[model samples]
Target chain A: PAPDSAAQGLALARNGQLTKPPGALGRLEDLAIWLAGWQGREKPQASAPQVVIFAANHGIAARGVSAFPPQVTAQMVANFRHGGAAINQLSRTFGASLGVHALDLDQPTADFTQGPAMTEAEVVSALATGWNAVDPEADLLVTGEMGIGNTTSAAAIAAALLGGNAQDWVGRGTGVDDHGLARKAETVRAGLVAHADALHDPLEVLRRLGGREIAAMTGAIARARMERVAVVLDGFICCAAALVLQRLHEGALDHCIAGHVSAEAGHGRLLAALGKDPLLALGLRLGEGSGAALALGVVQGAIACHSGMATFAEAGVSGA
Target chain B: PAPDSAAQGLALARNGQLTKPPGALGRLEDLAIWLAGWQGREKPQASAPQVVIFAANHGIAARGVSAFPPQVTAQMVANFRHGGAAINQLSRTFGASLGVHALDLDQPTADFTQGPAMTEAEVVSALATGWNAVDPEADLLVTGEMGIGNTTSAAAIAAALLGGNAQDWVGRGTGVDDHGLARKAETVRAGLVAHADALHDPLEVLRRLGGREIAAMTGAIARARMERVAVVLDGFICCAAALVLQRLHEGALDHCIAGHVSAEAGHGRLLAALGKDPLLALGLRLGEGSGAALALGVVQGAIACHSGMATFAEAGVSGA
Candidate 1:
């Protein structure tokens, strides 16, 4: 079931009686009410949060579409294991268990400019890999990704799914120079042109233009909804995967929260399409689930304020 | 001294080698550099954070200037004492020591519409009280306030300091109805008009048209700068206090960060006057340092990413 409106109302009423003015907590109050509704209780607790980083290599790197080489993808996975990556430090700081899934780092996707990024069967397998990675015991889940040149694939997928020019969606992934950025934009354009027939079907779009990590993230989001776990989405790549999931399941975004707005070009349009407002907008463009991991503390803080705060009646404080 | 430009440049250079693209971390990188410069160290740590909630009563409440009665101010102070207020909960969540100081809760300031909010001597004493509240051992300080109808006082002070009409500065504080908002606006206009002779001097403006808590907050900001402590400023009321400090001392904002943009009407103009970009934009209007406390984690995350995470060269990962 969706969040319970009755619990939300009760929480809202309780907030009015708290020591502060009505709606003074602003989005924190709304967050508390939403958590109450989602938890089906007057007070919700965001305990045992988990973060998963889906990583894979993109074949578009062969075309010099990204500033960083594809080998960095495998290297970053090792960094995650060694607790040296930004996501690792963030997960530890925010008290979330970090899970790094290197889904096909050894097998780069086919260059989508000329052909489908992955076979249909590979996409399904990747989705299942993401779906099965969810921990039912987690109170909250955050989705993140790490793949060199995956931004090109994400941009291609976004352009096809969102119906805009490739130039509008393409950005300087990994601080690519002007030439590399132009090449990436052209690569997305060519991929979209090649997959025009498949663009209408979300699944076909994922197989043709999206990388395995994105497909996996979509599956992860779907599974999180099915398991009734709240998901905090990272930046553009994760949001692109969410777009695919939202298209397939109309209410898929009901369980998700945008953690931060990415510095990518099309992210604003993508977020608008999903009707989601991000909590933080610090211009984060890192893709290793860093943005989402940074948001875990905020979600926890919101839940703590909801579950642990004292009401006016309880605190012997006068109401407004 | 101001933030060390050399340290900031060094940190910026270091960020480029941290596996992600240059400027990929966005505001987080900037935060790291800012902290580095402020602390005069290449790596900074937000180790000990302190939050002070200055509570007082507003005489303007008798004129129907607020939704809540004046007694709620004293009642909320008791709530803070018992660790039941939102600021208390946020303080605990962010690992900050919470201090609630009721400078003169039983004695409401004189209604500014009729006369000065406080005698000049009382303003100086309150400023000293706020100045002495700073913990020199603390790494971060957060300022918050609790006073009914204080928004009216804040709006009036902002109108005088920033050169605006009362209607532009007035907002529906504490969920005031349209009639109450209109009354509050009128009250500010009256107060500003009454204090027109003192409007040119920032301290005179605070004394004539601002509440005791606002005066104390101004002192706190000034003291934080002197103590070299980083301050996370709360919503509109706190920003109003900061404007006074900034006018009195040009570098008062050097140690401050706007925690969030309040829902108040004139807060945008106030923040613009100070040239501040708030970290959180959840429309929080709660005054008791709740927004600043909530921002502690984000600032910490930025610092951690700067100090703890590995560089691409160290991790054998290719840089953008």
Candidate 2:
């Protein structure tokens, strides 16, 4: 669904009436306008933001592609639930609600290097899990992931969808050394070769090469568009999930904004591919919605200024 | 005085024990460490941040350099006092204390193109006003300005210190047209020529070519270092203020970080000369402490994560 054009038009006019120069706020002016359009209100608000975390185990962990074992996925989920993780601290700092959903952490997806990562039914179920996780009442949404070896899956998906080589999409995940990075790249290459036929269809590509958490992020983002909740996409794996949706539907990610470009090398490339102008670039790489939650402050600040500031006439200030 | 290196070392050790992988948080990790050092605590806090706005009139407005008239500076300061400006909204959003100071708004500085912008006594008083504006109880600080035609003054100062031509440092401030831009460049050149003899000393350069608000920002930043409060520098004029201190004393801006790289053309060049990596780059050009106030969220988030997250052993999460 397209955003309300009337609200956007009204916001544009209001931006010009503010005390500063026409575009003095720069991207923040655009952010307020974008929020107004999505929320269907000339005055947008960012009071209620939601952050959801999807956790799953990828079978690719057996390939020694990740520094930590797959069980760490379940462990981190426990940490998130107990409010002991970085995302939890960020959520608390921003007053954002944090939701953690673990998708069959004990049952890992099939290794994509050997065969399809998930059957069509399995992929559909994971997508539904993600879609159902979104809160319709949330004015803003951010989706994050927790899956060991998932970077390898995201790399394979990018290689399939964006036509990049495995090395181009792969980066060190969870502090992997040089040899591990090389091995991860090779693993992605093998997965791409195995899933070559399914690359024709974006959903099929997701089913064959995407992990459950990544697919869940895809579903959640798609659901955000339906619910009229603006989304802030986080890091590399989240962008890979958005890629599947961007390829699946024309203008699918229009309601979404790149929260921040991470330190992961592939993230910049993925942001470029997604046609997203990222909001923040603090060299952050932590995935569990930390970057997006941090950016919630910026999004909130933009809306606050848009709604809270007085126009030139109201302030009795002269304009150019 | 330098930051507490002992606290920084302890904070570094604590960072490695957090649940996430080593350096997974990227620049945020460094921010946390920096905060810890400045605050002299292993567990840094961002509970209170102060934003100070200095307003003045520049005589160069008579040269038709800015889009708005000179009177608009006083008008905007009144708006700020009434809590009707963008900075007011941002301050409310981040819970920062805002102090507005109008430095002799009725008296515009002398035109620098003909002679020094301010007498030595006037410049010293302006700096002292900035120095006295800071709140010692605040944990973080941001300095902003409201002065029409001040960008022209900042450009002349940048060209003087950084060895650039007037055209290289001049930009379309407050949305000037091409003709106004050319006029601004010529005005900056004239100011530089008029003040050539006094450019040998940093304070003399500030007195001869800098506006009151710009000098105020310089004094405020230096006061922040003395108080051991971490500073986040704003846009082009603010950087030009910082440059004076950076050249006057070695490592003068060691306690400061560039808040955001603004859309003003000279801001990026000024940031590069200072060797300070900016936190946000949303192309913001509004100079009313808006960029640095927006960045307060990121700094708060970094410290929150650093102090709030549980250690790997405490969370029972697997480590690499």
Segments in model 2 whose C-alpha atoms lie over 4 Å from true places: none
lDDT of 2 by residue, B167-245 (tens): 9999998899999999999999998888888777889999999989999999999999999999988899889999999
Docking class of 1: medium
Candidate 1: list runs displaced more than 4 Å.
A4-13
What are the per-residue Cα lDDT tens digits for candidate 1 across B1-320?
57778877888788777766778878888888888787767887775799998988888889998888888888888888988888877787777898878987888888888898899888998898899998977878998999988899899989998887889999987789999999988999898888889898999999888888999999888888887788898888999999998887777698788888888888888988899998988888877888888899898888878888888888898756
Could you say which candidate leads in TM-score?
A: 2
Candidate that scores best on DockQ? 2
A76-186 per-residue lDDT for model 1 (tens digits): 999999988888878877788989899989999999988999998999999998999899778888988989898889888888888988889889877788898899889
The clash numbers for all candidates, in the given order, read 0, 0
DockQ by candidate, in order: 0.73, 0.84
- Candidate 2 matches the true fold with a TM-score of 0.98
lDDT of 2 by residue, A1-320 (tens): 89999999999999889988889999999999999999999999998899999999988899999999888999999999999999999998888999999998989999888888898889999999999999999989999999999888888888899997899999987778999999999999898888777887899888889889999999999999998999999999999999999998879999999999988879999989899988988878789988888899999999989999999999999999
Docking level of model 2: high
For residue B42, give model 1's deviation from the true position in Å.
1.7
